[model samples]
Target chain A: MTRLLTLACAVFTMTLVGCSESGSGDDTLTVGFSQVGAESGWRTAETESIRSEAEARGIELKFSDAQDKQENQIKALNTFIAQGVDAIILAPKVETGWEPVLKKAKKRGIPVILVDRGVEVEDESLYVTLIASDFIHEGEQAAKWLAEKTGGKANIAELQGTPAASAAIERKQGFEQEIAKHPGMKIIKSQTGDFTRSKGKEVMEAMLKGEGGDEINAVYAHNDDMALGAIQAIEEAGKKPGEDIIIVSIDGVRGAFEAMVAGKLNCTIECNPLLGPMAFDAVEKALAGEEQPKRIVVETTIYDQSIAADVIDSRKY
Target chain B: MPEALKKLLWPLAALGVLLLFNTAMNPAFFSITISDGRLTGSLVDVLDRATPVILLALGMTLVIATAGVDLSVGAVMAMAGSLAAMLLVDMQAHLSAVIVLTLGVCALAGLWNGVLVSIVGIQPIVATLILMVAGRGIAQLMTDGQIIPIDSSPGFAFLGGGTFLGLPFTITLAVSAVVLTIVVIRFTALGLFIESVGGNETASRYAGLSVRGVRLSVYTFTGLCAGLAGLIYASDITAADANYAGLYLELDAILAVVLGGTSLMGGRFYLAGSVVGALIIQTLNTTILMTEINGASVPVEYNLVIKALVVFVVCLLQSETVKQMIMRRRAVHD
Candidate 1:
């Protein structure tokens, strides 16, 4: 009898707590965020930014990690929909296969915000806005800097990312188109580095021994890790990287800053990953029935050796 | 020639054909120069980059010779690299301490898989599959899902990037490890024991051989080789990327073992053959990167397709039945 009475009191106390939570009305917003897995330092930093931002805003956030799988992301979205969340933020792993689940969210009248990467849906109404850095612009920026630094004359060795990836395709296209503007700038040796440091080093080593090895004057890598790897290869080949061969790459990660400070890397185009404030602001506007634009492009910054030492300390990633 | 010597002929011929083709296409492919007191050439790069795969194949050869496979070698690499980076970068441990602790943990990980396979009676594939998935997760946890850079350590970088007598230090490390392994397995009766267990496990057990002990030893040894490889890889890049450090490299190691004429059914391993097989793969990669047509590197899309065709042709050439069919057809035409 005593056990039953204690259980009754516990249940009565939980019910009272639940009643007070709903009694507080809808001022407290609950949002769900589905993140692609922590595949790189940039990705981890993005996730950290979002989580801390949610905490600061006093919003109840339900976060899910997809581990780089589309199916897992879809499952997270369905769960959020079942719970009747006020909003959903998805960092899609790929560009396709999100139409059906996103349509389900639309039926439930919940707004969706796409972050970092977007999905291909036939219905634009499925998502309120997409906030991401422009990859092609990043490539164009690297080319422009290299052209300016080299005075429009250089034989470049290009260290590309993985084959057929969207980033690789767009970056190659952008760099080629921009470099075509200056006839003196030409890519003498180009190969895929697969966006990893080791492969980058190996490819650079091979290309350094190939024809035009001596004539190469500049290096353009799709990411900072590859540029760093190329730096090692260039150093081993008895060439000064930043001085003898101007080097520029995308992804303004912290390691790039260190390399710049050491005078081993020339410049890095910033692919800023801090999107927390913008995502939350968009969420708030959507909640208030305010119309948002179809897309939001985050501004980027280019970092060179001149400011690397000053900016390295404040870099979050 | 003896049977052992004859078995090496196929892989050697394949490697020779590739080198000849590369030389014909690019006259500078064979040229070597001394820069910064280190050898610089396509050939040296091939040997240097083949170090990790060569080491993994050596371990994989022993495991396959025992009629079992360890799918977790790649994951073990990730774990070992992550541990080393954490110890050196985060905990600020000494280089020697970092090496010993990282390899020790990897061996323990292999021992765990052995216990599950030998004692708990789980299939080797399923048992190792558990660690293959969870090991990467454990690695990410150790690094807090960040790529840890181990910079400012010339002593550590020497393992992968330093030069010894104008050749990469990695080549020397891989060669010495392969030689030591060969001596240990061949000079001792361990070779016979492994063959007996894999040839017929119940028969070996009835013949008073400890099957479980042999399996345990092979797995532990493989774990140690993978740890060494992980160190070389992280040293080469000077950073530990948990997600892509040894991604899908287990398949490369297995392919190298099979290409060396070591059957997956497990018996009669060839250490030299595995080394040559790894060279073949690396040479293929170097060739692809060095080749150019119309003033541009071969479209990156054709790379894997060409690799697949070449590997398929080599496998077909290695088969005895196909050889007989070709010989018979030639005889008929004559």
Candidate 2:
């Protein structure tokens, strides 16, 4: 029993030692960041940007990868609050399970900044500023390109992103709003690809079979991964993809441009993911007691086959 | 009625009632069509979507028959695809078909799992869990965490995208696997031995059956199923993203297996029931997406609720007390 107690003490002491090493620093602007993990390329870039930006500004950034779980993110946030960090940044896994944590942060006077994703809190005072791309606008840009390319008439299919994500919800709404204007444009079938390439291909193949390859005038994806997957399904059906069935999607990742250069993808809307520098700028302003808006929209651009080749060299993310 | 039929009656009846209710609500629910020499619409979609789940559940049925469970099938799928992608990187176009390469890699991954469970004497859950966490990481490491695009594999494309006699090739593969599993379980003595081992390992050993061999074979078989599903998955996309392929598929496969009346504690097995369970799950998902409920949303996450409800209903039906109560109530009404 004595040995067992010593062993337990040793383990607990080791954890405390590790925590102190990670948390100790003087003249440090402690910033707690809860990430969604290395789930995608965009997320990795976001992590890198935040790490580098924090380093450059001499801020001690305590980073936590929640591994795509809401409970993990909440635990990390509470840990940060307990440590008494100056500020907190969260990329919420889901929108609803955040009100309680954000409320705790608000009670402690710890300002929260939402990056890349948004939360569904009814209280506007929970978060200081939300730095995210205009998801609906990204959808609108893709739809606008498809409309002009198809002359305001096409039988289209939609490959949506993950269901619970704010990006997917807003993007679908935005695309539907734009497509609703044109009487000739119709979405014959739509399904959630779950922001995954494999599922995108599977759903796209089903859509192709149901609508008939020729009936599908275009394909609109919530992101580049699904669009790329749809391209594969189109080619497998012994039909030309970009020429026979046009494709439009969002996310300005390099994969989209590569597809564009190959003439397999027609258009892609750029949703800038590297928001670390701008996010830090907001953090600085908020720390200085300046009132920041509840919403901050990031800039975006639409790239088609025409500009895809030229812009391929300069595409950062 | 036979004992097996008696065991399966309630779940089948429940599934029928659910289908009947759904068809009543939607006029176009039962509209299945074959147009222009191809199967079109929701039926085709359900078949295509159920392929992976059916494959995994078939393997899982055998694994559960040995009193063991594999929570790593989905991760193994990703790992197998990632390994195949890595192998194809150096191979010339004329060297091998992508389908052959994918199968080879998947087989090797299955073998790895088999060795860990049988030789290392690790708990099946822990053995596969290691692979589950590390497999995706390995896949990411293989592709340098990038999506590897493959556009020129005709054989590969056919596995996922091509149709065999007006049916998707994936469905054909799944059906073939189910049939093969049914043959193994019914025609051969392997099924009886597996049940004996799961029922009581010591008793099976005393009876002179190779219990270790049975356990090893089931794990390997599960791995092979996951591998085949991975191939179909990658072929459908024509690209491999190590991060997202087959994510959370093991959960769905387990759900399908459990829903089919296969006990998590092990001993009897069912292949055909699992196939039907996969279809029921896919149909439930489709119904949720098609139906417009006030203040409710349709997304992958929403499927979790539907899955939970289905599991609850199936479990309730499986309970002898509940079944007897329902029968008594029906008799009184009649």
Candidate 3:
């Protein structure tokens, strides 16, 4: 009985030692990353980039997938806090309902870095910085490109994303704002595609029939998937997609590049998902007690048919 | 009218009203135009888009008639699409192999639900709900959560976007499946067995019916139907998006079955009614998409509200109590 008791004590002590060793080390930075689940190709790419970047930087990343539930994210945040992680990187599934858990992390002096998405907290200090693409800017770039491509006059058929989505609303706002400057570039028809290829095709087909078949000259989709669907619809209608109805969309996914290469898509604005290097840079700055900006907008690029072929291979997502 | 034809009246009427409203709104709503050796128009679009819902409702009708509901049909669609995409694009497998393996896996998924419900004696809803929740996750795992775009499979594309005899291939597939199901169920003793089993499982068992086998067969058949629907849907988009493929379509199927006058409690089933029910839904969607009020597309928020109102009216018209109430009110007024 004494031997058994001694064995239990030794095991317990070793476990405690092991746990402490993993919890923190003098030189190693442990970042607890709460991801918003593998909801899409974009999200999966973001997660992969973050993981690889963490490995390259020699930082220990404690990863947790929230599987698209806000509750799971809050639970992950609490677990990271309990483990005394050096920093917390959260790609929140939703914008709201994060204040209380973020407050707890703030009290522990752990800087939270938002990736790909941001949170809505009363106190801006809850997160050190937000590293995300400017959706509205992407829309402006698309509109500016279209205006130039069409010589500042075109009938644009806008394919919005899911209604009420931040990306959809912001992109629409930016595109409309920029297009308003061009008096002849009118939005003839605007409809929601719900951010799916099937709906995009279906809605585009109806739009073509509702307006006379040859009325609209351009389609502005919120994402590449929708743009691709629109291409099919345009082809089915006996109209050349890229030539007859200039197709432009956001999200520089590989599908967009392929469409551009095939001469079906005119242009696509990049909503860059590779934020790992920049996110780590933010983490380092925050840990060193440097003041960080409230939001760090990742630089984006516009890809047209001219550059699509050369850049297609390098595009990750 | 025959009993079956009578049951289809409400759904057909509702569909007719929607079509009339659409024609009034857009003069080209019913105009079928020949383009690129195939039919192209708003009406054809409605039929093409209705393929998935029609297929799902066909299977859902049988399952519901067996006094069991399969909630996993939508998730099974995602699984099948994911498998097809992964095989065709990622593995670069042959189109025939991809089709066989995808349908096989979907049937097995249904058999899993059947085993849980019939063999283990669990409630059908809870048994099928297991797959409904986990099926999409399994699909995501297969594709590594990527939207697998099938860019080069013209042979497979024929299932979704090809034309046959100047008609959308999808429309032909849906019609053949519906007709085949009807012939198999109505001409054989299978339909009677299903209705008997659904009417009273204990009573059917007493009468020497293999209740377990009937339940298993119906669930498996439903799974097969969902697999075909998934294939068509993925092919339509030319990609397999595990996240959104057939998402919430199971509810649409259930609504279709109900709108076709199938009771939730089970017993009677209507195959043709279910097809019309599916058409009603697709027509509603196309109408909403085509309708432009004040030069702006109809608010999507009102789409479901209008659908619900139409469904409610159809159900009310089919209700015996409601019919009696209306008749009594009319007589009193007279």
- The CA lDDT of each predicted structure is 0.88, 0.79, 0.89
Residue A304's lDDT within candidate 3 is 98
- DockQ in order: 0.64, 0.25, 0.60
TM-score of chain B of 2: 0.90
Candidate 3: stretches off by over 4 Å: A1-24, B90-92
Candidate with best lDDT: 3
Displacement of the residue B160 alpha carbon in candidate 3, Å: 1.0
Instruction: Summarize candidate 2's per-residue lDDT along A87-176 as a digit string, tens digits.
Output: 898988877889888998888788999987788889988999889888889888888889999999998888888876778988999999
Question: Residue by residue across B50-77, what tens digits does model 2's lDDT show?
Answer: 8988898988888887888888888878
Candidate 2, residue B333: the lDDT equals 100
How much is A224 displaced in model 1, in angstroms?
0.6
* Superposition error at B207 for model 3 (Å): 1.2
- Candidate 1 lDDT tens digits, A1-317: 99999999998787656544543457888889999898777888888888999999998899999988889999999878777778999999999999999998898788999998888888899999999988888888889998999989999999989999888888888888899999999999889999988888888888887766788889999988899999998888888999998999999888889999999999999877888889999999998999999889887789999999999998877
**What is the per-candidate TM-score for chain B?**
0.97, 0.90, 0.98
Please give, for residues B1-334, the per-residue lDDT of candidate 1 as tens digits: 9776788899899999999999788667899888778877888889999999999999888888888888888888889889999889888899999999999998888888888888898988898889889988888888876778988677788888888988999999999999999899889999888888778899999999999999998888888888888999988888888877888888889989888878888878888889998999999999998887876777888989988988998888889899999999999999
The 10-residue segment of model 2 chain A with minimum total lDDT is A205-214
